[model samples]
Target: MTKRVFIIAAVSLYIISAYFSFYYFSTGSISGLTQKINLPLVKYKPPVDSKGNVIIDTSAPKTEECPLSGEMLTKAHKALWEKRRPLGVMIENSIDARPQSGLTSADIIYEAVAEGGITRFLAVFYCKDSDGYVGPVRSARVYFIDMLSEYGDFPLYAHVGGANCNRTTGSGCGNGAPADALGKIAKLKWVSYNDLNHIPYPVMWRDYDRLPNRATEHTVYSTTVKLWAYAGEKRKLSNVDDEGNEWNSQFDGWKFKDDESVNPSEAGKIDFIFWQGKSDYDVTWEYDSKGNSYKRLNGGTPHLNKNNDKQIEAKNVVIVFMAESTARDNYTEGSHLLYKTTGDGEAIIFQDGKAIKGRWRKKDVFTRIKFYDTRGSEVALNRGQVFIEILPKGNTVNY
Candidate 1:
């Protein structure tokens, strides 16, 4: 037994030495000394097209409309998407994790304050593939699960960890608190089915090389193609689950329309903040008339995707005002938050350089949230990326 222990220790030390040597050679410094020392090495590569070309061909005819964002794509892209379901990844927006990798690739994004005035994103990917890694992956929150449920039957959810309660003490969640995300996932029977929590290997990795000086919490990443493949092979979940039930059987996709011809000066800019004094998470969207899109700015700086180095732009920006409160469960140092998700709320829909005052409604967790203008008609979003921001009720949006 002593010999075996010594052998194991020796092998572990050798592996660690090799890892640091390689890191120093590639990055010119061992800045990860303070990062998570237990992180696994990055070994997976981004996916490539089988045809030896880019994922999307700009010259191809854009006939098929994506159900997620209503963006038109080639038949080839549509065919590829049909074989997979939506993937909701938990991406952090910490100041240290700026210029995230794959925000522009997501079809739809839901942003809300995770805790302590820091915002997080539940990026839903389906109609298109990410340019590369999709994170800086973070832990899950209960309200994010509520929003992700609208995707379909057994949507692939990827997160590192989550807010959990001490059921024995009845402190964090089980007694009455609704902020226990991990518990909720277990009750939903998504443990090994679709809830990819701390999944190792080809699903997720800690890429210290991506951002050398970042902390471990902000170094985790995963590619969309790898996530989909893992769901299919390991969880028996794809376009259909193990029982052969299609994912979209009860799905409710939002309505979409072409860009409406409108004057640019009508609603040229949008500004909002999640918390009172947290300027780092402040958001601004400037409308572009020619492109019919809104370019995003964070903390007064243009937010760009690290993968392609392009500014993050969206055709539609929907702001939903809901009641927010703290869980008071003491799940973590930051404390978890709870949001009223499955009810009616005031909303503002921005599209085609115009802002439409509207209301948002959702029947339940699985039901799709829809936006309706003051005239009581559904607001059709323009064809492109959709960004949904959930703000505290009574928070003001300046446009």
Candidate 2:
């Protein structure tokens, strides 16, 4: 075997004979001499079994991204981000509609007080793999129109027809704030999934078992499979604006991290006072360190999703304080509350078990809203589901 030596100054391997000899001399006279060196030879060794049989591993590494959380995930868990379009289902959140269905599977849940201090939720699901029931579905509110607009490119909005009501016309005046909000958005030309039944696709139905015990209005529900199927058939899956101008244009979602950058305290008890009637509006969150998430409670008891028998959990809790206004609601026959959504406001974000005081700003309907701390640093959230609580000013959010 020849000895191999690598020369650093030039691109060549010098292989001397098995026996080496060295000589040092500097008598070279310049222009006429050149040397060509060879590289060292390497032996090849193939991987084989004990029997000298070649084996090729054909299994591919499984990897995917959860669109909602934007985190890399393995294929073992049912991915909700597989669908091309995000979906928003209007789920009722009254005393009657307790033990909600399919809430644990939502990516983001928006909660706001409806007509008479009763709150409602617009649960958004981008990863739509949940096949379970989604709601005791409710009618849309005026403000819900603006809230749902904060989601995907082409979002599927499923709700019953809604408008504000007057005390005179117990059937609802049809020209109140809720309907006015609906009309404003309709001018933007948003097509939706509703309970008109027999047009486009038929997906909304009532659970008879729930209807007997509760009001007929509170029994309407839909499933993820049904919504996906209906949306696909109705040609509502495309992200294009049929009328004119792009909707939800130029949006890059919030920043997320694998884990929180700051150390979180044991802020286990959370209080979300959504209304002046604290008796009816009381809500709380208890932290579970083992899961690194918060479990929801309504008035001191556990809040559960009846469909799957699971409590609502979130990695981030964002309470945005907005200016509130009142109007004559034709639907509820009382005062209609409208929360201004398109302005800069103070917000507090709870993540990694600690509460961070921040401010949120949204200039217009199309612009992306962001939360920043007092120093104007953008607040980063843990990569998971987030609950956006639209609390009015003077409301309490203690953790």
Candidate 3:
């Protein structure tokens, strides 16, 4: 019991294990060795709820605030986006795909029609910035996968093929296999993208200065940063839905207006038409109220944003009449429209400049859609940016 007290306790446990290994490699953080590695560091602090907002904790710490846009986000967009998934994309609304490319940084845009009546754009991008240069990119539609399963953020579709076919002659418009809609979004394994396997390199491209002025099928294009770095190197991007489903990430009711001085109900102002006339899927919007915002026209003009010339504004458009159909493209004679973004509809909701017929309500196939008004309430919008439209019922609203 005494080799000089066991060599002075093994040289004081080797100088406290070399001073906690030089204090954890000179503070590469063990938070000062949490009581010398006793280890309990839990200080999360996220819970806010009673409308103060903050509550999404995907394990909290990438600088948060983007659980679908409570804004202020960027830690590489909360660590490489796709947190609660929702990316859709597929834009290309003819008239030579006019100035399109990340549709004014979409948070929601649907438009509809496609396959001849022209219009086509699903856009969506969860809480913003998918990387940019969003596209002339187009295709894949079965009602844009029922408007990405009625907007419960069920996305990750991205496109460059559908409504017929071409990925190097795997067929033609109305092509077979799982009966189109990009081969039923590649047989429901959903995580789609159609650069026909160019992999990590070309998500889709061909702008030879707008490729000899449009039509190699609107000069194929892509770039939400090479479509999420080629769907995260082919694991094929996910926040779920290869059957796993996941994505009720909940942004909750999206109401807003505790201050844009409460607008939405001029009952009908400046315009918002949606196929009453001037086709190309009629989309109008107008309503400036000195930038209380609306803008986007297309077919009556304006609607810019080829990445930046401006124009395409919005505070909310919505519309959603619902009830169109046609379906029949087993490869050509063209025409595969459909669009019923799921159950009940009528919803008007323009905003600031006014209009609010409202009623949309979608509750199933994964929730979150509500629009209400005609007294049933809900119609709260104004927090900025939304286009939706998706018309049907004999169209013709003109405001």
How displaced is residue 132 in candidate 1, in Å? 0.7
lDDT of 1: 0.90
Off by over 4 Å in 1: 1-55, 167-171
lDDT order of candidates, top first: 1, 2, 3
Kindly indicate the candidate among 2 and 3 with the higher TM-score: 2
The lDDT leader among the candidates is 1
lDDT, candidates in the order shown? 0.90, 0.67, 0.63
lDDT of 2 by residue, 15-43 (tens): 33211222112322223323323457864
Q: Cα deviation of 93 in candidate 2 (Å)?
A: 1.0
Model 3 misplaced regions, further than 4 Å: 1-64, 67-86, 89-106, 118-138, 141-155, 158-258, 263-315, 318-350, 353-385, 388-399
Superior by TM-score: candidate 1 or candidate 3: 1
> Candidate 1: minimum summed lDDT over ten consecutive residues — where?
39-48
Better of 1 and 2 by TM-score: 1
Clash numbers, per candidate: 0, 9, 5
For model 1, how does the per-residue alpha-carbon lDDT over 90-188 read when each residue is reduced to its tens digit? Answer: 999989888898999999999999989999999999988898889999999999999999988889999999888876765676447678899899988
TM-score of 3: 0.30
Worst 10 residues of 3 by lDDT: 192-201
